[model samples]
Target: MLLNGRNAVVYGGGGSIGGAAARAFAREGARVFLAGRHPEPLQAVAEQIRSAGGLAETALLDALNQQAVNEHADDVASSAGSLDISLNVIQHGDVQGTPMSAMYLEDYLRPVSTAVQTTFITAQAAARHMMEQKSGVILAFGGSGTQEPGQYLGGLITAFEAIEAMRRQLAVELGPYGIRVVTLRSGGIPESLPSDMEGREEIAGAIQAATMLKRAATLEDVGNAAAFAASDMAASITAATINISAGALIDW
Candidate 1:
């Protein structure tokens, strides 16, 4: 119940990571607002939460739409009395596994552009309410770090780095209002990959092998970390990246 009485808004709440975080938030006594472009998945997560006796709601939303994002934030704050947490987990449309030289410029830049746009819109919308209440937590997925040579991740790494930069800037600007901004960096989550994804086993193996613990982060790990990071127990933690990679990412 670390987040008791809090209100958390999660973009892309239908996705694996988002849904996990939403459930965790609700379990900790937060009223979770699941927002995404799809209704079915969002509703599925909401129903699960409600079945568990947790407060949950769903909204069909395009995180890319600034006006829509703003309106939604206003509505949530108006109804909930405060916006305590905001997390953007929207897909960035990244085309990985293709070498930059062979990739189209749009494909190379799509993730970078989409990541920044959706994050900015959602964070901005939440910030307005957070600033008013003088307290909030803006959570972001992904973080910048070393990548293996020839990984051919396209702009995925670049997109993550861009988000880290933005997170730092936001944390600095929003610090005065007691709003904390943090990013969760993971090596990889095998459960997040589709069962039929190409080279799925190899990819998961590589991810596990890269970590010192020989295990990639799990959806549950992410949920637990997210709940802690969003809670008052982490009030002193901000402008930082929480490494949940289990040694997959080594920081100096």
Candidate 2:
């Protein structure tokens, strides 16, 4: 139980990555609060956790809504008595496979704006509580990385880079309060992609080929990494990006 008795709030907890992390957090003895726009998926994850003898709760709300996010954080802290961890994995609405030259302006900026807005709102809400406690972990996903030529990933990389910058700044500001901020950088997770996604095989293969380990990260790997990062064992880790890309991304 790495996170025994901890209370964690996971934005976008209904998604694949978020669900995985939530499950891991619950398994480690943390009472997980899954927040997302959809009720069904959130409830599904919650049910799974309960079935496995773990504690979990679901909240239906938009992560980008500042008021909603703030209220949710307040509610969680009030009920749980402490907010130990915060993780935001909301989708950025990125449009991939379109060259920048031909991409619409809104399409290119959607992810950037969405990522920043939702992350800022959620992190700020968590930071307020964390500062009061003088101890907490704020986790972020999608670390910056080099984009391959012809990849046409649109603004996905840009959005990630923006988040990395924010994470560093948050870490610096929150450090004095004993709040740790870290980003989990992954080359990609094969299982995260939809089974019927266009060019799914090629994309997964490219991801594997790009990784030094010849294997893309799995949902389980992300879950494990997130649990460790959010736990007290990682108290000394902050203002940093945990490389979970299996060599796909070289830090140095």
Candidate 3:
């Protein structure tokens, strides 16, 4: 049990990646608090964890609400005695892949603003609890978008770029407190394919083809990576972006 007595909080726990991380943490012996805007999926994940004999809790929370987010963190800290890990997998609901000549300025800007603020609020809440313990982990799952100029995903690219920058600064500020901040840059995982997109199989296959490993990233792959970061295994690492893109994002 790498996380044998740890406490983990996962925002956006209703989503595929977030749900996977929550389950992975619980399996590693960490008590997990799953929060998101919806109850059904979060509850489902929590139940699954609990059924497996792991400790779990669920909260229907809007990531943008600073008060609610902080209050939830406080409760988790109080119950668990310390906060070991905080992971934000919240979605920005941004319209991605819009050509530069096609997307409206406000549309591109909206997701950026939303993602930044939610991330800030969640991180701020987590920081307070972690700072008190002087030992914790902060993890964010964000694409390495800003690396390229605005392309098809102008909206999300900008948002993720800002997220990466903010995550780096957080690493610097929180390192002194013995709190590690880490980011995961992922390539497309099959679970995220939109229902509206026709030919899901073909799209998934193409994404895998584009990867250097000739296979796309899996939910378990991400879940395990996140669990590793939150575990004592990554004790010496902080403020780093662990790229799990299967060589998709490399410049070379």
lDDT of each: 0.95, 0.95, 0.86
RMSD of 1: 0.7
Better candidate number, 1 or 3, judged by lDDT? 1
Cα error, candidate 1, residue 55 (Å): 0.8
Q: Write the per-residue lDDT of candidate 1 for residues 1-252, one digit (tens) a residue.
A: 899999999999999999999999999999999999999999999999999999999999999999999999999999999999999998999987999999999999999999999989999999999999999999999998778876789999999999999999999999999999999999788899878889999888988989999889999999999999999999999999999998999986
lDDT of 2 by residue, 68-96 (tens): 99999999999999999999998899999
Off by over 4 Å in 3: 145-151, 196-199
Clashing pairs in 2: none
The lDDT of model 2 is 0.95
Model 3: what TM-score? 0.93
Candidates in descending lDDT order? 2, 1, 3
- lDDT of model 2 at position 203: 92
Higher-TM-score candidate among 2 and 3? 2
Q: Name the weakest run of 10 consecutive residues (lDDT summed) in model 1.
A: 144-153
Local error of candidate 1 at residue 220 (angstroms): 0.1
lDDT of 3 by residue, 141-233 (tens): 875743334336667877888888998899999899999989887767877776677667876786676689887888898999999989888
Candidate 3: worst-modelled 10 consecutive residues by lDDT: 143-152
Clashes per candidate (backbone, < 3 Å): 0, 0, 1
